[model samples]
Target: MASDVRFSDSRVGVSTPLDSLREVLGVPDLDTALLTHALTHRSYAYENGNIPNNERLEFLGDSVLGVVVTAALFRTHPDLPEGQLAKLRAAVVSAKALAEVAIELQLGQHLLLGRGEETTGGRRKASILSDTVEAIIGAIYLQFGIERASEVVHRVFDPFIARAAEMGAGLDWKTSLQEIAADHGLGVPRYVLEGTGPDHDKTFTAEVHLGGERLVVVGAGAL
Candidate 1:
């Protein structure tokens, strides 16, 4: 846990972005180039000499992180309701959480930014840090696989997740829906079961009605 991470290319055997990620995360087998793609911001790429951005890895990382956090939440809190578990997972995987992890890993210093992004203080931006960190996690999983990525993520988020577990249930989708209805100056929403699918594979369709008015949007899910 070094306090101040330097961006210089002087470290031994740390010539590439994956090397930088490995050095920073204390995990080997890191594809330095992929990690480079992870930390690379679109702005930096645009400003730099035709360097690629991190959007693709960011997308993959977002899903990977969601799965990781959801699985962790499910395993850690068996007694908690699903809604609460989802909320807890949401909090755990929030941008803020990712940004904190980025800071802990000293990721900003290692970013290969373009001169414009660097000048614009992109490294310190929370959005950039959060996205970059997720991208890195995605890249790490792709290179090192699920076992290593899970180990690394758990190693990073253990304490926070533990604290959240101690704190208890967090997700409440129904409540959120209710809140939306309430805020929209609508009366209690009436959920009408639109249709039921076949016996083998049942599907539930729900539509919310506001003030005796049917909602335009309908939701479908496996029962």
Candidate 2:
């Protein structure tokens, strides 16, 4: 899609019309009107006044996604204990994974955003994309049912699941990070400035640390 597909204010659209999304998602009968609502973000809704955001659908989709992910985990890991199942669930629903799926579906291009969000680049944000993805799943479940939502989820999550299985080990990065931070009695790690450059060009250095030991990562870009 073209970059010009900016959100109405700057949040809801940056892609071609959602007519194509239904085709990509394989839900031929999925109502386009609902999709308009699905794509509408609260920020955009506030500006329009006539339309509402996808929040309610997002709320519904959150639970639907949980159910779909849990059910898949249960069916796939019949032998694994609860701990393992929880790990798989986390892996499937992680912000990273959902954002990846949203990208795969090209969903980000269709988001509706308020001008503030658009000017600030809300389109590529993981939190917004992930929440919108979940909301879409919920909207599907409501319009159809678990069967449709599950089918779509399976199709959407297939690559992620296959990759995880190939890794041949349980995913525990987030979990391990928590324990390691706690063991060192670190309340939380934060970023502190570490450099400078010209007005249009700059750099950032962030440190994730526990006690006196810190891991610093530096990145450079333009505002």
Candidate 3:
């Protein structure tokens, strides 16, 4: 891997942005162009005589991200139904989630924005952050294969996965209602669940009662 491309060798500049990113990502032997391309936005690319941007890499990374998240979800949540698993996956791979990860990585600091974008606060934009995160993933995958890329993804998103798992559980109304009730010092919520109609077209209703509370919140769903 070290010999695969031209190493920086201090040719560009000392204490450069790439050096900072290399140290942050712990990939000392990373290909310069790969990382540079990952950091380059379309505006910067156009400004620099139409040099390549990260969009292509972002596209590739989207699929890589999906595979990584899907495999992790499948392994970790084997008991969850397919629908629930999909929801969890969607939450984790969402643009907002990726942008949050990018913020944690401080990737915005390394972006190569054009003058106009820089003036417009492009560094803090969620779209740019999320797209760059995916591009970085693509670059890592191309350089070190999926195993290393998966490691990077996991390292960057471990906290996010934990939060997403909690959010996924909250999708169950009973669980959320119970948690909310407990938070409000209302003890556990009691629910009287009932259903109507045939199996093919059934409507279910849940009447929830909190401790010492006269108000009842009714939730309904169809199966």
Candidate 4:
């Protein structure tokens, strides 16, 4: 889809309209009006009096995204300390991360921007895209249920989780492994560890599953 639009007309033809988002979201019958509202920026709403913008929806979606990511992180990394889990959550929910997801979905193309915003390149702005993505999530949650919203959240964020793991970003190898699993649309990696011999002279073996291909890693440590 085309990423840039001209501001010559007040209403630019979005190359990837709300209907095109259906395939990306995996929701075939999304409500057009709700999605349209999600795409409307405050500037645009002000210009077109009586039309609502996505601020409220963005507020709700921010909460919805938090719950979904928090739950997934909690469930997936049972062995991870609270600090690590929180860090991972923060990374995934960061505006930069959401903006990347919006870019991947070509959501910028679908945004409804005011003439000034359009001329100023608001379509390519990270904040606008991220907020719009959140608004869309809110719209989905209001129309569907938490279950569907969660699914969309995970689906959109899986690849990002993988990238996070690859970067390490202060996370341990085991945490990275679990994130990798989640990235591949798989359940969290399950780790099995065993120790043998005396505490002072013990050998430990650890095994874990990672990735959609279900790659397994085994390692041994002795003290």
Question: Per-prediction count of colliding residue pairs?
Answer: 4, 8, 0, 0
**Per-residue lDDT over 1-223 for candidate 2, one digit per residue giving the tens place of the 0 to 100 score:** 4421122332234343665787777775666556667778888888888466788888888788778877877877788667656777777788889999998888878998999889988999898899889878867787778899889888898776656543324575445556556766875555465556775666655445555656644455444
Quick one: best TM-score, which candidate?
3
Off by over 4 Å in 1: 1-21, 165-223
Question: Which candidate order results from sorting by lDDT in descending order?
Answer: 3, 4, 1, 2
Model 4 segments more than 4 A misplaced:
1-16, 165-223
How do the candidates rank by TM-score, highest first?
3, 2, 4, 1
Tens-digit lDDT string for candidate 4 (135-191)? 989988987889999999999987666554343365476665566666667787877
| Model 3 C-alpha lDDT per residue in residues 84-130, reported as the tens digit of each score | 78778878888888898888778888899999999999999999999
**Sequence-dependent TM-score of model 3:** 0.70
In model 2, where is the ten-residue run with the lowest total lDDT? Answer: 3-12
Please give the lDDT score at residue 217 for candidate 4.
Answer: 74
In model 2, the clashing pairs are 5-14, 11-112, 11-113, 12-111, 12-112, 12-113, 13-111, 61-138
Candidate 1 C-alpha lDDT tens digits along 174-196: 57667667768776767788657
Off by over 4 Å in 3: 1-15, 169-223
All-Cα superposition RMSD per candidate: 13.8, 10.8, 10.6, 13.6
Work out the TM-score per prediction: 0.65, 0.67, 0.70, 0.67
